[model samples]
Target chain A: MRDTYQEQLDELASSLAGMCDDVARAMRNATRSLLDADLQLAEQVISEDMKIDDVRASAEHQAFGLLALQAPVATDLRVVIAAIHGAGDIERMGDLALHVAQAARRRHPQSVVPDEIKPYFTEMGTVGVALAEKAGRVIRSRDLEAAVELEADDDAMDDLHKHMFTVLMDSNWTHGVSAAVDVALLARFYERYADHAVAVARRIVYVVTGQMPGPLAV
Target chain B: MRDTYQEQLDELASSLAGMCDDVARAMRNATRSLLDADLQLAEQVISEDMKIDDVRASAEHQAFGLLALQAPVATDLRVVIAAIHGAGDIERMGDLALHVAQAARRRHPQSVVPDEIKPYFTEMGTVGVALAEKAGRVIRSRDLEAAVELEADDDAMDDLHKHMFTVLMDSNWTHGVSAAVDVALLARFYERYADHAVAVARRIVYVVTGQMPGPLAV
Candidate 1:
C-alpha cells in the first residue's frame, strides 16, 4: 500500500514536470510567433494553449485526488498545496504567452512592433523563452544552483521592461499611441511572464529546502 | 470529530470573507487616493496592504493546517483548495490596489492622469470600488444573483479599459507619452483588480453550487 502511494507521488511529480515542459514550449513559440509575425505559428500557439490549460487542470485534479485519497501530510501536504499555486502561476504564464501570440495575430502582417522597438522585443522574447526553459529545468531537477540563479536572470527582463518605458517616454518616440500601447502591454506581458517564472522557482526552492526564497533579486 | 472539522471549515470561510472585505476597502481607498491624489490616503492604502497580506497568510496557514490535520476529502477538500486559490486572488487584488496607490504616490501633487482622460478614470474608479464591494457581498452571502452580475459588471471595466486605449489612440491625443503610459497602466490596474474579484466570485459559486462559475459571471 505504501509503495502504491509512493508511486502515485512520483506520478504527480512527473506530471508537474510535464506541465513545465509545455509551459516552456508555449513561451518559446508564442515569442517566435510575435517576433516573426508567422500567423500559422501564432495560430498554433493559440490553439495549443488549450493543451496547456488541460495540463494545468489535470495537475490540479491529481492534486485534489491525492489530498482526498492518500491524505498526504507535512511536507507531502505542502507540496500538493504548492502545486496548486505553482500550476496557476505557470498557467498564467502560458496565458501571457498566448496574449503575445494574439497580439501578433491581431496585427497580422503589419509587424505590430515598430522598427525602433523590434530589437528590444526580440531581446525580451529571448529572455522569456530562456526563463521558461530554466523554470523547466528547475522543476525537473530541483537543482538548487539553477533555482538560485532564476531571480538574477529575471533582472534582465526587468531592465528590458524599464527600457521599454523609457523608449515610450523619449521625446523622439514617434511610434504613435497605438504602437506605444502595444509596446507597453507587450513589455508587461514579458515582465509578468518572468515574474511567474521566478515565483515557480521559489516554490521549487521551498519544496527542496523548506525555506522560502527571499525577495525577488534585482 | 466531524463536527470539529466542520467548525474549522466554517472558520476558514470567515477568514476568507474577512480578507475579501480588506480587498474591497483597499481597492476603494486605492482608487480614491489615485483619483483624488490624496497622498495621505494613498500612503494609508500602501501601509495597510501588509495587514491584507497577513490575513491572506493566516487563511492559507489555517488551510494547510486543516489539510494536514483533518485530512478533509471531497467537497471539504475542494473548499480548502479553493480557499488557497481564492486567498491568492484576493492577495493579488491587494497588490493591484497597492500598485494604484504607488502610482498615486509616485506622481504626488501632479496628477498622473491628464484632464481629458480624468472622466474615464473617474468612471473606472467608481466601477472598481463598486465591483470590490460587490465581490465582498458575493463572497459573504454567496449570493448567486450577485455572482451572476459580476461578469457584466466587469464588462463595464473592460469597456472603460478599451475606451482608454481608444483615447490614447486618438489622432488628436495631445498628452505626451508619459501621460499615455500612466493612463494605460492605471487602467490595467483597475481592470485586473476587477478580474480577480470576478475570479473570487467564481470560486464562491463553485463552493455554493458545486459548479464552477463560467466565464467569471458573479
Candidate 2:
C-alpha cells in the first residue's frame, strides 16, 4: 500500500509535467497560425485545448485523492497541494495559447501581425514556448537552479512584450488603430503566457523550499 | 480537538469571504481612480493591493494547516481545498484591479477613457463589484442559485466588453492608436476581474456539488 501511494504521488508530478508540454505545443502552433495566417493550424490549437483541460482535471483528482486517502503530511502534503495549484496555472497557460489561436482565426486570411512586428512576436513565441518547456523540467526534476533560470527567461519575454508596445506607440506606426489594438492584445496574451509559466516555476520553488518565491517581478 | 478543527474550518470560510470583500473594495477604488483620473486614489489602490496579498497568504496558511493537521475528508476536505482555490482566484481579482488603477496612473491627468466611451467602463465597474460581492455571499451561504446568477451577470459584463470593442473599431473612432491601446487594456482588466469573481463562485459550487463548473463561457 505504501509503495503504491508513493507511486501515485510520483505519477501526479509526471502528469503535471505532461501538461506543461501540452501547453508548450499549443503555444508553438498558435504562434505559427498567428504569424502565417494558417486557419487550420489555429483551429487545431483551439480544438486540442480540451485535451489540456482533461489532463488538469485528472491531475487534480489524483492530487485530491492523495490528500484525502493518503493523508500526506509535511513535504508530502505540500507536494499534493502544489500539484493542484500548479495544474490550475498550467491549464491557464493553455487557455492563453487558445486565445492567441482564436486571435489568429478571428482575423482569418489577413495576418494579425504586420511584417516588421513579426520578428518581435516570433521571438515572444519562442521565449514563451521555451519558458513552458523549462517549467516542465522544473516540475519533473525539482531543480531549484532550473526554476531560478526560468524566472530569468521570463524577463526576456517581458522585454519582447515591452518592445512590441514601443513599436505600436511610435509616431511612425502605420498599422492604424485596428491593427494596433490587435497587436496590443496579442502582446498581452504572450506576456500572460510567460507569467503563468513563471507562476508554475514559483509553485515548484514553494514545494521544494517551503516558501513561495518573492512577489512576481512585474 | 474536533471542535477546534471545526472552528478552524469555519474561520477559513470567513477568511475567504473576507477576501472577496477586499477585492470588491479594490475594484471599486480602481474604477473610481480610472474614471476620475485621481492619482491619489490610483496610488492608494496600487499600494493597498499588498493588503489583499497578505490576506491570501494568511488564509492559505490556515487552510493548509487544517488540511495537514486535521486531515479533513468528504465535504470537510472539499471546504479546505476550495478555500485554497478561492483565495487564489480572489487574489488575482485584486491584481486585475491594480492593473486598472495603474493604467489610470500611467495616463495621469489625461483621462484614459474618452467622454464617449466612459459609460461602458462605468457600467463594467458597477457590474464587476456586484459580481465580487455576490461571490462573497455565495461563499458564505453556499447558495448555488446565486452562483448561477453570478454567471449571468458576467454575461452583462461580456456585452459591455463587446460594446467597447465596437466603439473602438467604428470608422468614426478618433482617439488615436495610443488611446485605443489604453482603452483596450483597461477593458480587458475589468473583464478579467469579473471572470475571477465567476471563478470564485464556481469554486463554491464545486465544494457544494463535488464537481467543477462547466467550462468558462468564453
Candidate 3:
C-alpha cells in the first residue's frame, strides 16, 4: 500500500509540473500578444484560462487526498503543501495573463504602450518565464540553491517594475491618461506575478532547508 | 495527549485573535493620524508595527508547531493554514498603514490633498476603518456570512478609488506634478489596504467552507 501510494504521489507531482509549463507558456504568449498587439493570441490566452483553473483544481485535490490518506510527515508533508500552494500561485499567474490579454483586446490593433517601453516588457516576460521554469525544476529536484537564485530573480523583476514607473513619469511619453492607467495596471499585474513566483520559491526553500529566507535575501 | 494538544491549539488561537485586534487598532490609528495630520500619532503607529510583527511571527510559529506535533486533519488543518495566511495578511495590512503614516509625515503640517478632495479622503478613511474592524470580527468569530458581506464593503471602496482617479484627472485640482504623484500613491495605499482586508475575509471563508470563493463572489 505504501509503495502504491508513493507511486501515485510521484505521478501527481509529474502532472502538476506539466501544468506549470503550460501556465508559463500562457504567460509568455500573453506578454508577446500584448507587446505585438496580437488580439487573436491574447484571446487564446484568455480562453485557455479555464484549462489552467481545471488543472489547479485537480492538483489541489490530489494534494489533499495524499494528506488525508497517507498522513505525510515532515518532508512529505512539505511537498504536498507546497504543491497545493504552488498550484494556487500558478492559477493566479494565469489570471494575470488573462488580464494582459483583456488589455490587449481593449487596445485592439495598437499597443497601449509605445515602442520605447518594449524592452521593459521583454525583460519582464523573460523573468516570468524563468520563474515558472525554476518552479518546475525545484519541484522535481528539490533544489535549494536554484530556489535561492529564483528569489534574486524576483527582486530583479521588482527593480524593472520601478524602472517601468519611472518611464511612465518621464516627460518623454505623451500618451496621456489612458497610457498612464494602462502602465499602472500593467505594472501591478507584473509585480503580482513576480510576488507569486517568489512565494513558490519560498515554499521550495522551506521544503528543502526547513527555513524561509529573509526578505532582503529575496 | 490529544487533550493537551487541543488545549495548546486553543491557546494559540486566542493569541492569534489578540494579534488581529492589535493589527486592526494599528490600521485605524495610522489612517486617523494621516487624515488629521497628527505626526505624533503617526510615529506611534510606526513604533507599534514592530510589536505587530513580533506577534505575527509568534503566531506563525505556534501554528507550525501545532501542525507538526498534532498532525491535524481536515478542519484542524484548515484552521492552522488559515491562521498562517491570516497573519501574513494582517502583517501586510500593518505595512500599508505604515505607508499611510509615511505619506502623512511627507505632507507634514500641510495636507497633500486639496479641500475639495477632503470628502474623498474622509470616505476612504471611514471605509478603511470599517474594513479593519470587520477583519477583527471575522478573525474572532470565524463567521463566513460576515466575511461575504465584507467583500461588498470592498466594492464600495473600489468605487471610491475609481472616483478618486477621475477627480485627479480633472484639470481643476492642478496641484503640480509632485502633488499629483503624492495623491496617486496615497490613493493606491488606501485601495491596497482594502484589498488586503478582502483577502483576509476570503481566507476566513476558505477556513469555514473548505473551498475558495469564486471571483464574482469575492
Query: Could you give candidate 1's per-residue lDDT for residues A1-218 as a string of tens digits?
Result: 88987777667767777777787788788878877888998999888888878788888888888899988987777778768888888888888888899999999998888877888988987888788788877877889899889888999999999988988989899877788888898899899999998888888888787667654432
The TM-score ranking, best first, is 2, 1, 3
Top-lDDT candidate index = 2
Better of 1 and 2 by lDDT: 2
How far in Å is the alpha carbon of A86 misplaced in model 1? 1.3
- Candidate number that wins on TM-score, 1 or 3: 1
Candidate number with the higher lDDT (1 or 3): 1
Candidate 3 local lDDT, A1-218, one digit each (tens): 98988886787677667766877888899899989999999999988988888888788778767766777777777777677767877778888878888888888898967788878888888898888878777777777888788878888889998888787767775666556667666776787777777778788888777676774321
Q: List, residue by residue over A1-218, the lDDT tens digit for candidate 2.
A: 99999999999999999999999999999999999999999999999999999999999899889988999988899899889899999999999999999999999999998999999889999999999999999999999999989888988988888888898999999989999999999999999999999989888899999999888854
lDDT tens string, model 2, B14-106?
A: 988998898899999999999999999999999999999999999999988998888999899999988988999999999999999999999
Give the lowest summed-lDDT range of ten residues in model 2 chain A: A209-218
Residues B1-218, candidate 1, lDDT per residue (tens digit)?
Answer: 88988998888878887887787788788878877889999999989988888788789888988999998877788788878988988888889889989999999998788877778877887887787778777766879899879888989999999888888888898977788888888898889888888888888777777777543221
**CA displacement after TM-score superposition, residue B126 of candidate 1 (Å):** 2.3
Greater-TM-score candidate between 2 and 3: 2
Off by over 4 Å in 2: none
DockQ (CA atoms), all models: 0.60, 0.79, 0.32
Q: Give stretches of model 3 more than 4 Å off.
A: A8-12, A216-218, B33-47, B102-115, B169-188, B216-218
lDDT of candidate 3 over B57-133, digit per residue (tens):
78877876776677788877777766776777777777777877787877889776766776787788788778878
How many backbone collisions does model 1 have? 2
In model 3, what is the error at residue A36, expressed in angstroms? Answer: 2.3
Task: Give the TM-score comparing model 1 with the true structure, all chains together.
Answer: 0.95
